[model samples]
Target: MYQGIRIAGFGGQGVISAGILLAQAGVEDKKNASWLPSYGPEMRGGTANCSVVISDGEVYTPIVSAPDTVIIMNEPSLPKFEPLLKKGGLMIINSSLINSRPTRTDITVVCVPCNKIAEELGMDRIANLVALGAFIKKTGAVTLTSVEHAMKKVYKRAKPEMLELNKKALQAGYDAVK
Candidate 1:
């Protein structure tokens, strides 16, 4: 199966961490994976993107020239990546910030009002987790439990208290789509 995926959004939105979580989950499943991000100057505004690859064999390039899946969390991401998504690919969009829709019927798109949903939950920062939850549910790249496990591994050293709140945010995102 096509395993290359790209997640793009604003810098502070957690796209980088989401990419790391995907890579960690792949490692947990014993699959070959790589996570690459664009982090030079356009950190928060100009451009912010991450490429993640998960496969049964070794990965070649970390830069995803064309991705099998695209998770777009802002309006800018759509124009940035719509032309790069492969045919019959999948896209999970954050409906909270973006309004334009992908024109291709060959690709699947799932819109999650992540920021609004998280805001309603009293935590606007968890919007990233909400987007992550929708991405996981839409792609099934890894199980929710696997994502949670990967999350603990991600936050244990840096932000332990964030784990529970992010997990709850993920659950809320799941419920929003369900």
Candidate 2:
């Protein structure tokens, strides 16, 4: 497996949360993991990026200059992060917001209408989870069942009430991909 992953998007697109969940799952599976979130102009109607490292050995860098996978939720992030993904890496793009086609042919692209699915789920925020579910399926880096367990374990401390909704969101995301 590649040593690094990056999830980039807008502020409210849930990039940080998704990164957290992915990192937690990776660590739970006995892999060393690190999550780093960057916020600036990109966070406000611009680009936001989070680096998640999952490695069998100790992680060397928390910042990912080149990512093995990219999850894009907006057009701005598409261009910003497109070049950073390694050749032949997986890219899960939220086509609901990103209208442009990728220029890279080497990377495998999965364009899913995640915002539409989230809206159908009665919320427009779960698009990140949908993209993440597709990521899990394509990479086999983490399982949906394991992610569910991680979510409960992680969110239990801060927002115990979110347990059920997040579960539904993850399941909806997984089902949409299927």
Candidate 3:
């Protein structure tokens, strides 16, 4: 299976980190994966996005012009990437930050109040992980086990407390979608 995922949001929202986690999960599961990230000059508030291609075969490029799945965390990202989502794609929207809904009918839209949910979990910073959890659950591109393993490896340098918090956020997001 080939899954091209684009996760976009403003800077400091963990957009890049989420992409990295996805690619790591794919690699942990023995799949071919690539991640390409880009961001605006402004660090915290500017736009940021990353494309992740996960397949059972070779991936020639990291670019994803038309993603089969998109996770948009802000209003600006919606307008920028919605049009590029492939027909019958999966659009996981952060309803807590994005007020408007997509007008397109061909794609399946799953709205999760990521920020709200994260706030409820006592850490708004983990909102991106929540979105990632939803994406992983909905797409089945990567297993939760793989993501958990990646978290342990990727965040081993992080605060001991944060690693647990992050895992909770991921599980919360996955459960939120169901």
- lDDT tens readout by residue for model 2, 1-178: 5457888888888899899999998877878889999987676677888999887788888998888888888898888889998998888888899899789999999888989887877778778888878888778787777788788776667465566666667776666565
Candidate 1 C-alpha lDDT tens digits along 1-178: 4488898888888888889988897888777889998899879476588999988888988889889999898888898898899998888889999989988888888889999999987888789888878777777776678778888787777575677788888888777775
What is the C-alpha RMSD, rounded to one decimal, of candidate 2?
Answer: 1.9
lDDT of prediction 3 = 0.92
Lowest-lDDT window of 10 residues in candidate 3? Answer: 38-47
Q: Whose TM-score is greatest here? A: 3
User: Candidate 2 regions off by >4 Å?
Assistant: 157-161
**Clashing residue pairs, candidate 3?**
none
As a TM-score, model 1 comes out at 0.91
- Consecutive 10-residue window with the lowest summed lDDT within model 1: 154-163
Q: Give the clash count for model 1.
A: 0
Ranking by lDDT: 3, 1, 2
Residue 115, model 2, lDDT: 91
Model 1: per-residue Cα lDDT at residue 173:
77
Better of 2 and 3 by lDDT: 3
Write down the lDDT that model 2 would get. 0.82
